[model samples]
Target: MNYNQPTDVLLIDDDVVNNFIAETLIKRASKHTNITVCLNGRDAIEKLLSIKQESGKLPEFIFLDLAMPVMDGWKFLDEYHRLNIGDGSNSEIIILSSSVFRRDIDRALKHSVVKEYISKPLNIELIRKVLKIDHHTN
Candidate 1:
């Protein structure tokens, strides 16, 4: 994936400060200026449905946080799969969370839609890796 190209991204997290940092880093790293932030999984689901209804499209990437008050990441993933949200799109869900437990990592990676698991305090390098940005090109 080319970082220079502008793409839509969905970020689901309840942390305001982390969200701000993530949005800034995402914009700087992948040039994904179009990012929608949802405080919880439920909100993310609503946003995804809304976007699909409005444009018949979905974001290319989804940054999911494991823990939240309203509908956790696991529940969202279940709903996403149950609803076939990625049937016609290349929407990859990346588990972006602070949890570093081995079980958490294993469980997340086992999920079909989850492309990769990334720790919190996301930086430019992780963003590039998640977006598959060619390192040499940049």
Candidate 2:
């Protein structure tokens, strides 16, 4: 864990607009942040596996959406746990889904990788307050 290294954040969502918004907010929160956006869970899984293979470095944080076309967040989590590529502790996963169902929230909370669950339309405030990023700077 090199504090000097730029923090990497991965966003797994199908919505291009949401990705853009999340990316923008993340950049504002921390200029040093490096964000990777995947359209679906499958793509995200492939990207993560590639990262693991090449650099052996996983993203510091992941913002996951439950609803997707190819592979949803639930299936992704199942595979994520099965693959065991992530150290579980290094990459902190936060569910950023639009679903407000208690069942959905409960299921996500049960997952070991998931640290927190947030409602969609991500904002800078949640990034700072909930995640405690607080606009990190050099």
Candidate 2, run of 10 with poorest lDDT: 129-138
How good is model 1 by TM-score? 0.92
Candidate 1 regions off by >4 Å? 2-5, 135-138
Per-residue lDDT for 1-138 in model 2, tens only? 243668889999999999999989888877778899999999999999999989998998899999999999999999999999686448889999999999999999999889999998788989865446635532
List ranges where model 2 is wrong by over 4 Å: 1-3, 135-138
The clash count for each model shown is 0, 0
User: lDDT of candidate 1?
Assistant: 0.88
Give the per-residue Cα lDDT of candidate 2 at 116. 94
Q: What TM-score would candidate 2 get against the native?
A: 0.92
CA error at residue 67 for candidate 2, angstroms: 0.2
Q: What's the TM-score of every candidate structure?
A: 0.92, 0.92
Candidate 2 clashes between residue pairs 3 or more apart in a chain or in different chains: none
Tens-place lDDT digits, model 1, residues 1-138:
655667889999999999999999887776555899999999998889888889978998999999999899999999888887777888899999999999999999998889999988799899888887765765
Tell me which residue pairs clash in candidate 1: none
